[model samples]
Target chain A: MAKRQLLLLSSSQLHGYEFLEFASRDITDFLSKNKVSTVLFVPFAIKDHNAYLKKVEKPLNQWGFKVEGIHNQENPVDAVEKAEAIFIGGGNTFRLLKALYDTKLVTAIRTRVLEEGVPYMGASAGTNVATRSINTTNDMPIVYPPSFEALKLVPFNINPHYIDAEPNSKHKGETREDRIRQYLEEKDSCTVLGLREGALLHVEGYNAVLKGFTGAKLFVRDQEPVEMKIGEDVSYLFKDCA
Target chain B: MAKRQLLLLSSSQLHGYEFLEFASRDITDFLSKNKVSTVLFVPFAIKDHNAYLKKVEKPLNQWGFKVEGIHNQENPVDAVEKAEAIFIGGGNTFRLLKALYDTKLVTAIRTRVLEEGVPYMGASAGTNVATRSINTTNDMPIVYPPSFEALKLVPFNINPHYIDAEPNSKHKGETREDRIRQYLEEKDSCTVLGLREGALLHVEGYNAVLKGFTGAKLFVRDQEPVEMKIGEDVSYLFKDCA
Candidate 1:
């Protein structure tokens, strides 16, 4: 059987954030361009397009695949089990988590990606769901109920938009760099991907590639955050760590 | 012997934030209108006229007491130790840390504070420096020498401004709430404070009181963040646990 492919995008806009994106054209064309034929999954948008089913449909339609907003009672396992792929877009993590909990689709999605090995793709919240815990997200905690454990795709955390500390700040309070440093003071073992917007960790089977540049930094709470560039020696964390 | 009185301000005017001042007009005047009849010593503000000094000078100077900044490198210890009130003004925490480290005044300040029983008032950086470690700061990480052992005034981490979540972003990146949730997950023993600008935690000996209305929220990274407003109970923590 061919190894399942998982594409995790932090944001839909693919280009401009050098070393953050693999391609720069249309998202749907980008997906189809990669020869990904179909995707069966819900659009987990929460903030800007939290309810953006149109964007999801546009991409899936352009790729000649049928997309549906899988309701909890829709038997997601059946819908996604035989699907070519499951692409989950980003939005509000809290909202997405609520939908997952309400619809009971988290388990089904996890099963589809892990057991059946159907390719799982997510952007933003979707990317967050693929990890062990969604605690690394830079989103708000406005809504709370389901808690922060993600799909556990990778047993680590992702601090997307991995920005370092500038000497001064435009905001008055703590900067992103300071907050992450503080977080690291506690968590020493977990890996934190301080991915600049376009940066990504492409994992397939037991191998993970740094598709972007080498200056991107990674932080594991309680430890020092370091930089990583493309082609650096890195393998998929999940397959080997597990 | 008159003990050193320490005044710790949150941040400088350069940054768009001023803790009590920004929170309300009353807070600024309340802090500034205090009178001091007796002679006092302030060892930190010699080099600059930060907001703390600028705001409080009218009242303090009215008392006929001299307001002096302790910038003499010859022996900062003498000034710090003899001061009536040691005021720590707010600025880039990194800059503060850098000065403290460079001057090697951290030790003297700690000694004057704990051993001498110096009556100290800390604003922004002052408040941050009072923590076990200022890693939770959202400002620039200009200095990361790791001073986890703070003044031990409070028992939890502080996330100032207390922004819940931005209405933008569509990724799975960690939000401020998620960070605290994860912190709580790792260490439930410690409490995290999401203090709003106006809110101040008054630590009078064993009692920790929440002053002002803008109260604070609580979170343990990887879990949910909760708002703990005024008229609520509070507690402290140990470094081993945090």
Candidate 2:
């Protein structure tokens, strides 16, 4: 089997940028390099599936790829199998995972991405599903899936839109770091990649790179978080994930 | 049969305040008025149950009440049955609910609080569990309980440590308001009470009052969030929750 290709993004929009504008170049380049022509979009995370599809369709269509939402397809699983590339949008993680389980698309997508080597792109809730489990997601459990288990395409969990503790904030709620630490306490073997806004992980099989304007934070079960520089090679994450 | 009495606090410690200090007056007054001689403390939210017990016991003891941790009991169910009052400290909601389910204490505590009329108190994760489910909690999904369904002592869900959008902040992550809205989209009948730090709800059977120094925001399905004043009667929440 060929190497699995994936682009895991923290968010679709940056602080002041338009929809998918910040990562537009990287997204288009990844698709072009992979020779992907048709893309299947998963819009289960948000409430308005049609609106989400239109939001994503315009951009990918402008980039020269025919974009189709899986929700609109007559056969969702068949769409996943035949698509040249797949893109999952962001919203509530629990809702997204529930939809995936309900459609029985988990196995179909896994076979397509991991085994058939179809390129995959995910942002926020989408990025969450590429990981081992949704255990590290920041989204509320608005709904419950059959299990917390997710696609283990990436051995470790991905915490999208991760923010650090505010130096002088008065709010007593748990900081992003505190939440990640609590997660580490519960599961010993798992590692979390904290992807800040505008950051992403470009993965090609066993090789992955922390690519963006900023760096990422890597958190292990019992160790302090280490910084992954803009161009740092994170392939070792794949090895440590298992 | 009598009015179910409960104190659901957003946090144990407010910003720069001593442990449970901000709510000391209300807590002490509630216990004293109820003539609660011994209070059973459930410290299942955090891993260090012993430390948690010590933190809460110091204050309540000075208030002239005997505080014992449920974890230290030979029979937890019996402890709840015999206890005059119950207190659940906060940390991680998922961990707290998992422990409650693991020890088979959910039904035990529910019976004591709802049927036997034992005055119950909760902070943070403890507060989250006193509601319909832990779905509105801000804590990470570090662990999964058998179900997200919690003690429905209160009609609506409690979102403890609720923070509003920062006007000038550049973070692209979802605000607390955004999360609660998503939750409403999934479960329309549910109403979420956004309890900011230091704010709390004092529920007396079917009638609940929003207490504390600050006001809370009440979120309903397909409607604008209503700001609940400190002394506002929130009995209407009971009708909308079911």
Candidate 3:
């Protein structure tokens, strides 16, 4: 099989950065190097369709690629099968996964990306569904999908926008780290890649790498979280993870 | 049905307060008026059994109530059925809900509290599950339960530990308000009560009131969030909520 190409981003924009500014260059290069002309965009995560499309168009247009919202097409599955590349935007994970499942596009997208090697780029909630299950998401469960299962494009799960606790804050809610630790206790076999903002996991077939301006935290069941330096090899996450 | 008696707390402890200190007075008063002796404690949310039981025993004992862990009982359903009062502690909501389903205790607890007039007290995750569903919880999914449907003791959903966005922070993730807004968009009929820390909602039959040190924000579908006074009546939540 052709090496699977996936760019799973923690978020669309980092602190003080313009929309998609942090990952714009990487995204543009990914599309350009592949000689892609148009990319199919999944905007199901956000409720506002016009605003999401407008924001996505400007950046991708600057990168010399045409973008179309899948929701506008006659058949979303057909569109995915024929798309040169696919981009899923960020918003609510439950809504996004439900949309994907509702339209029967999960299998179509998985086949295109994993089997046919179509380029897949997603941010935030979009990045979450690229994993085995949406169980590790930080978003509210505003809506329940058919199941917690996702595309299963990757072996383990991804916790996007992984942030540490506020040092001086006295809030009683559990920190992001504590929530993930509880997740590990329930799911011992699955590993969770805590992708901090401004970082991403890049998968090229069997080899996956931690990339971008910042590092990420890797959490496995029963083990302390290990920090992955930028550019560090994370291919092991793909091993025995699925 | 007997008048429903429930104490849905946002958290067990606030900063600079002992365990259950913030709500200790109200708790003791409620139990005392009911003439309750031994209370059954549901500690399924946390993984550590001993630690949870130890922490709970201290505070309830101070109030002259004997606390027993429901997990230690041979029949959890029978224990809840016979209990004078039930206290569910805070932790991961998903785990707690899943455990309740796995052990078939959801029905037993509901019957005990709703029919038998046994007082139901819960903090954080426990509070989340007392409503129609656990969709408004802040904790990560972590694990999948049989369903997101929760104990329908209350008409509307309770979002515990509900804090506003950091004023000057650079975090790009959605704020608590933004998330609740999205939830309303999807669930227009349901009302969400954002109970801030150091606050709680006390339900007595068809009447519910916001009590404690701080006010709460009520989010209804397509309406601006209304700020509820600390002692304001919230019986409206029980009206059309279901």
Candidate 4:
């Protein structure tokens, strides 16, 4: 059996940078180290698959990798089976998950990544689907999927583009922290990783490390959230659970 | 058949006001005009139904209405049948909807409000569930309900606690307007009312009016969002749709 390899990004674009520019070096290194040449891109998260493909192609092409959108293929499942690497971009999580389920790519992608060792790269909503469920997303529920369950490539959930509450703001809605706490109230057994912007988690086999510029927060059932610094080994979070 | 009556508030609390205080005058007036002597409260949105019931009881008791929690009733559906009015408080929309479905209150409340004309009052999450669907809510998907199809007490959908983008913020997440647009992309035929905090919609039979201190934004398919004024007669939005 092949060991699973993944790179989950908090966001594709950081403030004051081009698309995927903030994590360009890390993305290129991950693909190159995995010896990947062609990348199969899942662009269902956004409305326009063609336009989304173009946006990603320009950057990966500059990095010497060919990109093909899975939407263009007749058999998306077969495309995932034969792909050297898989990359799912950011957009609406609900839309992304619905499309994945509609096109029957959830199980296909899950098997290819976990069993075949196909490098899986995801940003924002993509990173969200790689987790146990899309239960902790920040995006609106523009569409309803068959289920909130996702690929489950990882043991825990990810709240990408995670932010802290503003102290002086007058907004009456729940803060990101409050929302996460509400999730824990219902799913007390699950672990949630609040991935800040400009951050990525690099995983190899059973080991996972927090990388990039910013830090991440680990939220357990009843304990206070502990902040994790960059380069910290977070593989302990991958332990098996019900 | 009796006419359906509803008062869907954007939020229970405002920036510096007490819980449900911002809409106190309208709430009291609506209940008073309906000759409602008791309000059967749905406290399933929050974790503690007892605490939620107490919080709402304080204000309604001052306004000369007896407040009873549906959670405390022997049969929740039977409670709705015998109640003078139904009031659902704010918290998590998903949890509230799930509870509504779990306890078989969706159909009971819908029939009661639309057919039996039990006056319905909802704040935030409560407001979101009274519409055609809960797809437009701003709350996190902390729990997955059996379906996103809500009570359909109204002809359209409501996005409570709707807010605009910060002009100078560096956050890469989608703005409130952007999210509503995405929803329109998926469900183009549907109309959405973005109810800002401190605002509400007062409905009587076929007539609906926007009331409160703040205004709202009306979103239609393939049209620019129209800024609605307080006290505006928005009955046209109640037109029948697919």
For candidate 3 chain A, the 10 contiguous residues with the lowest summed lDDT are A181-190
RMSD in Å for all candidates: 12.2, 1.2, 1.3, 1.3
Query: How many collisions per candidate?
Result: 65, 0, 0, 0
Model 1 alpha-carbon drift over 4 Å, by segment: A1-4, A14-36, A47-51, A63-65, A71-73, A187-189, A212-215, A221-223, A236-242, B1-242
Q: Please list the residue runs of candidate 3 whose C-alpha ends up more than 4 Å from where it truly belongs after superposition.
A: none
Write the residue-wise lDDT of candidate 1 on A37-143 in tens digits: 65565764443333466656664565466666554225765776667677777655655776677767778777767666677777777777787666556554324
Model 2, residue pairs in steric clash = none
Given the true complex, what DockQ would model 4 score? 0.80
Per-candidate fnat, comma-separated: 0.07, 0.79, 0.89, 0.65
By DockQ, who's the top model here?
3
Give the lDDT of residue B216 in candidate 1.
Answer: 77
Tell me the tens digit of each residue's lDDT in model 3 across B111-192: 8888878899999999999888998999999888888889888878889998988899888899999999889889443999
What are the DockQ scores of the candidates, in order? 0.07, 0.85, 0.87, 0.80
Per-residue lDDT tens digits of candidate 2, residues A69-165? 8999999999998899999999999999999999999999988899989999999999999899999999998987888888778989999998889
| Model 3: colliding residue pairs | none
Residue lDDT tens for model 4, B1-242: 23989999999989989988898899999999989999999999999999989999998999789999998999999999999999998999999999999999999999999998889999999999999899898888988899999999887889999898899988888899999898989953389999999999999888899999899999998899999999899888866353
Put down candidate 4 lDDT per residue, A1-242, tens digits, no spaces. 23899999999988989999888898999999999999999999999999999999999999999999999999999999999999999999999999999999999999999988999999999999999999999988888899999998997899999998999988898999999999999943389999999999999988999998888988888899999999999888877343
Please provide TM-scores computed only on chain A for all of the candidate models, following their numbering: 0.79, 0.97, 0.97, 0.97
Which candidate leads the pack in lDDT?
4
Residue A144 of model 1, lDDT score: 44
lDDT of 1 by residue, B2-118 (tens): 232332233332235443344343333333444422323332322244444555555445534456655532577676766655656554454465566667777786776666755
